[model samples]
Target chain A: MITIAVDAMGGDHAPVPEVSGAVQAASTQDVNILLVGKEQVLQAELKKFDGWKKLPIRIVNATEVVTMEDNPAKALRTKRDSSMRVAARLVRDGEAQGWISAGNTGAVMAISKTVLGMIPGVDRPALAQAFPTIKGKPAVLVDVGANVDSSAQMLAQFAVMGEIYSRLVFHTESPSVGILSIGEEDHKGNELTKSAASLMKALPLNFVGNVEGRDLYTGLTDVIVCDGFIGNVALKVSEGLVDVIKHMLKESLESTIASKIGYVLSRQAFKDFRKRMDYSEYGGAPLLGVKGVVIICHGRSNDNAIRNAIRVATESATEHVNDRIEIEIQRWQASSTNDPEV
Target chain B: MITIAVDAMGGDHAPVPEVSGAVQAASTQDVNILLVGKEQVLQAELKKFDGWKKLPIRIVNATEVVTMEDNPAKALRTKRDSSMRVAARLVRDGEAQGWISAGNTGAVMAISKTVLGMIPGVDRPALAQAFPTIKGKPAVLVDVGANVDSSAQMLAQFAVMGEIYSRLVFHTESPSVGILSIGEEDHKGNELTKSAASLMKALPLNFVGNVEGRDLYTGLTDVIVCDGFIGNVALKVSEGLVDVIKHMLKESLESTIASKIGYVLSRQAFKDFRKRMDYSEYGGAPLLGVKGVVIICHGRSNDNAIRNAIRVATESATEHVNDRIEIEIQRWQASSTNDPEV
Candidate 1:
């Protein structure tokens, strides 16, 4: 059975949604669940469940909870017994196959790295998010805010991990990967993208060359890679724009009665569309290239987000994604190291 | 009266929107118009209006037309007789106070640099687009695909230009300017933003320090600046996300009849909000740090966009934004070279 460890006292919604989500996952999935948090708070919430006693759910006691506002490094040190740190340790110690957290992002990255260590040949761990494209296909965007100043080699590793992630999760055969560049031209983009693209173009994987920002949701390629800096800016800008437009459209359609009839005829497709666009339904981003699986959920995650994150964690463990990644890295090591493509 | 030169042969809509927009501007404002294109075509389009003989409109003879698909550099070189090229010449020769094009962006920038030249002490020109903020304020984001690889000095110039643009167009006093960084901490971000932030912080302008991508449209800062690679991605991704959300929302509101009624009650305010979020309503991006006013309209601009571009071009020239930018750059150069702020 797959065992998933979750940080119970994480995210803005706190123990309520976190514990409830774990309970829901327990009722549905056959995975053994461990929720790490203060026993009193978590148990009190769990008691609200209808049939929790029959499920494969367990609780691990932790002395402290990590606040979203706390500094990542300081919190990891000062609150060594915190739920987030303990949950990460569970994965590291092999008590659980994967760890999930909606807590401090920096702390999760720090703790996950400290405990599990980087994969054999990977430079740094990357956060990989799966975006459903216009073609209704899953495309993985890597290093969405992990490594700020990544080398060409690091980007190549991200592409490798992204390819594997897309293959395992969405079951794509050698997913097409593209490095984000200013222009699609080979000679275009900054020093970093140009160098990285040249190296990526030579990889054995299905490297489709440079893709622009608009191509992220276009589904023309399966993997989109960039350094954390550009990727973070692009992600946040896209999120903010989405929020603004949602607010704008909600305001616009309600203006007149005739338009209201126009809206009624399109409701079913619209609900399905909204459900498709919801990030929570896709669960948290996985910190790939690590020895153990760690899913980092958004701070504003709801009960559904927590549930999906657990589901993601369970699926990753079953697929043995980390083992596959290690094998891929080893297979690529000698060529990547001795040849140093680029 | 403001003399705004119109490149009648420019843009996808061509002489129809261009001529109609000129008539609209002339009807709406007391500005002198010099329409530069093939005289016969422009006259035929213009003769469709009654009482056109009394308006302060004049047509300049030009035989060539620059197609949207033409190479920017090649068009500027071979199409010296094109309407777009001649319009730039008019601005260069001081016959027109400003020039506006709803045609090819590359061609506009190319011919403008060839004719008008960049302002003294300015490193290079930067493009700034005004995004609507939460409070109806417009935040200017610079380097939206002008120069991909920017030096620290170039970014500092963008700050100065952004300040003047915000003050003259956006009407913000001192215009709190921010360098887009990965994090809010002083030591955060990649090399470019960190160095540019140091330069910006040392300047005399009201530098509010580094801001993240989330703060771009929150009215947190009057001006937001970044390298073209990051800036272009942010703008395009934001536009794509906006479209996605709008499409989703139109679908969602119609899902329920009661929600449709609620939307109807909120229609007018929503329209106002939608209008506020649109970038096209703000006319076009100015090629800042140039000697003369040059407005680069969207390639797909309609008559309304052409009209707005004329308005913005008129306003910028009247306020001497180009001269102010030169003065600011000169002051920044003198202060740095002599006093050495850093």
Candidate 2:
């Protein structure tokens, strides 16, 4: 059985949603889950749920917890027995195929990278997230917040990784990759993106050239690669805008009696729309390029989000995503050195 | 009377919407309008409207037109008599207090910069556009597509200019300025933004430190400054997302018969929502730091957008925004030299 470890002491609600999600995943999916946290706290939380003892759920005691405010590098050094670290260790020790966390992002990234190590040719691991597009398809955006101030070579690597992930996960035969830029033209981006574009063109991949911010939802490309700085801003800005748009729509819908009644009739449609745009449905972002399958969910993730994250983790492990990434990176590196044009 | 020059040959539907908008602005506002383009063609377009001779409108002949695809620097040097350049010349000769263009953005910027020059001590001019927030108030974003690879010092200057513009245009007292970054912490951004933050804190303006992408719509700050590259990407991305959301919402609302009826009932509310989020309502973005008032509109601008652009240009000239920016820059420079803390 494919076993996954959950950092139960992460997230804002901690232990409650984490434990519930783990139980939900265990009961539904064909995966055993190890809940890593303080045993006494987790045991108390687990007792609240029915059939706690029968489900494929086990608790692993972790002495320390990494708070959201803690510095990632420092926390990783000092809090060796933290829930996040312990969960990563489970994966490293072959006890679990993958690990899921909703902890401090930097800490999760640092701990996962340090414990899992890097895939053979990969210098830095990127965090890849899927965004729903208007075409009802999803595009994978890489380097969301993992590596800021990325070089052209790093961005090129991200494009390759993103392309492979899209092909594997989305089932696209030839995933077209685009570099996130200010404009679609070759002369539009900064020095890094410009250089990255040249390198991408030389690779044996379907590089669709530069795509702007609006393309994030337009389904213009299968995979979009950008520095973590740009990707994070784009993602966060979109999130914020989505919230504002929803709030405005709610206000408009309920402003009048007629519209409120209309809203009632269209409530199902609205639910469908919300589900389409909802990030939780997609679960957590994969910490791509890591040696092991490490999924990082939102810090404010609820039970549903956590459950979905585990599903992603299981699928990633089943697909052997890391192995494919290593193979592709080696292939690309070999081609760049062999091709005279490159 | 304050006179504003309109590039009649600019924009996608040039001389049509441009002519109509000029007529509209002439009919409503207390400003003389100079429609600069090929006089015969503009005259024919103007003849379609009633009472064109009675309105405070006049035509200025220009022989050449700058196509959207033309190289900006090359066009500025070669197309001496282009409509955009002529309008800028009109502003330079004091025939017009301000100029507005929806043509090639680079060409417009180059011509305006060359003709009007820069304010003393201002190294670069930023394009500032107002994004309507959920709070009903708008936040101004500077360097939307100008100065793509900006230095730390340029970003600091943008903050000062943004602050003054917010105070002058938005009628805010001591407007809060924030540097746009991936994270809000002091150590969160890349090298450019990190250094920019330090410089911004030294200025006398109400620097709110660093703001994330979500803060753009949250009304967390009145003015947000960033390098042109990031600003352009953010703005365009928001525009793209807005389009996608509208498309998705429409699809959802029209998916079923009951939802279609609900949409009919909520049509008025939807109309109001669109107007609130409409870019035309905000008019054009000011090319800040130029010696004369220069407003740049969207290439796809309609008659309504053109009319509003003229309104913004007139207001900018009336408020003497350039004068204030010059004075503020000089003051900041003097203060930095005297105070060791700065």
Candidate 3:
């Protein structure tokens, strides 16, 4: 059974969702869940569910919790026994094969990196999220919000890492990598993308030139790489737009009696649409380039989302994605040095 | 009557949409339309509309056409007699009060900037577009695609210019300006946004701290300012998401017989929803900081959009938004100089 560590004290409403999700995952999957938080609280919360002791779930005591307002670097230095830190430690100690958190994103990255270390030659680990596309499989976006003002070389590394993640996790054969820019032309974006595009061209990966924001949903490429600032803004913009569209649709459907009846009759279709667009269905985004499997979920995630995150963590750990990433990075670095233009 | 020059050869389906839109605008509004293109073709296109001679619309001959694929700077230098250039020339020569185009965004910006000079204190003009918000009035976003790799000073200018445009065009009182970033905190962004926020703080405008992508449609601020790179991506992402959402909704509503019937009954609700989210309702984006009013419509704009663009251009010209922008920019520059921190 794959063993995964859970940061029970993380997220907005922690401990409850974490405990319940652990129970659900343990009941369904052939995995072990180690919930790291205050032992008393986790036990109390787990008791709410039926047959809690019979499942493969346990609570590992953690003394502190990392709040959203804390500075990431400061938290890393100060909060030694924090839930996120303890969870990372569990993975580092080989007690658990993976770690999952829905806490402060920056703190998670800093703590995870400090405890798990980095893959050799990898400067920084990126936050890679799977976005649902209009086409067949979801596309992966790298450096979603991990590092801002990423260098061109770092972007190239993100491209390679993202490509490996897409291929290994999503099972895409020969994933096409594209640099997110204003236009598809070679010389269309700002200085960073221009440099990154040239660097990607030197790599052995399938670099498909530049892509625009519209291509995010079109699934024109399997992996799209960008700096964290742009990636974060793009993700948030999609969320905001989705909220507005749903609100507008709800208001419109309730405006007239006929539309109300129509909404009731088409509820199943709407349910299917919602399921397709649901972020929980894809689970958490993996923090790529780290030495171990670390899945970072949304802070507002519910029990269902937490369960899905645990599932993803189990699969990623079982697949040994980190080992492949390390090997691929070394190969890419060697090949990059061979190219004189690089 | 206010005179507006229409680039009759612009847009995907040119001349047809332009002539018909001009006829519609001339028939309704007290405005004269100068259709700039090949004289014979425009005249023949205009003859299709019933009693077209009675409308205050006429044709001006231009020998050349600027295609979409031409380089912006090269087109400005070579396509002297192009329809876009002629229309801009009419605005520069004071024969027309405003210029409107639905084709070649970069070409329009280049030709308009060259033919009609910039405001005295402005270094580079910005493309500002009003977006529909959940609140009362629409919020405005600046530097959508005008200049990339913009400096902090240029971003501050965009903020000031965007504020003036919002106050004048949207009739907003004391418009609040926010820097677009990953987070709303004072220090939660990349270097560009950080420096830009500090610069905006020194300005005379009502500077709200940093705003995020999720804040774009929330109407939390009246004006959101960013570099062209981020702004352009945000705009395109919204467009792409809207397209996907609409497509999904249509497919869902037609998936089953009951849903198909429900969709037929709820057509009015869907129409109302579309109208609320319609880009034509807000008309075209304005190229601010130019000496005269210049409205740049989308390449895929229909006849209704063209008519609305004419309407917006008339209002902007009559309101003398450029004069306000010049005065506001000078006032901001003077205030910024007085502050030692800036």
RMSD of 2: 1.4
Off by over 4 Å in 2: A338-342, B339-342
Where does model 3 exceed 4 Å of error? B339-341
Rank list by TM-score = 3, 2, 1
Q: Is candidate 1 or candidate 3 better by lDDT?
A: 3
The single-chain TM-score for chain B of candidate 2 is 0.98
- Candidate 3 clashes between residue pairs 3 or more apart in a chain or in different chains: none
Location of the lowest summed lDDT over 10 successive residues in candidate 1 chain B: B261-270
* lDDT tens readout by residue for model 2, A82-201: 999999999999999999999899999999999999998888999999888987888899989999889898988898788877887667789889999887889989988899999999
- Docking quality category of candidate 1 according to DockQ thresholds: acceptable
lDDT digits (tens) for residues B163-200 of candidate 2: 88889887878899999998778999999999998888
Query: DockQ scores for all the models shown?
Result: 0.37, 0.81, 0.81
Task: Point out the worst 10-residue segment of candidate 2 chain B by lDDT.
Answer: B268-277
Model 1, residue A71: displacement in angstroms? 2.9
Q: Check candidate 2 and list the clashing pairs.
A: none
lDDT of 3 by residue, B71-173 (tens): 9999999989999999999999999999899989999999989999999899998999888887746889998989899998899999988888888778999
After TM-score superposition, what is the CA distance of residue B298 in candidate 2 from its true location, in Å? 1.0
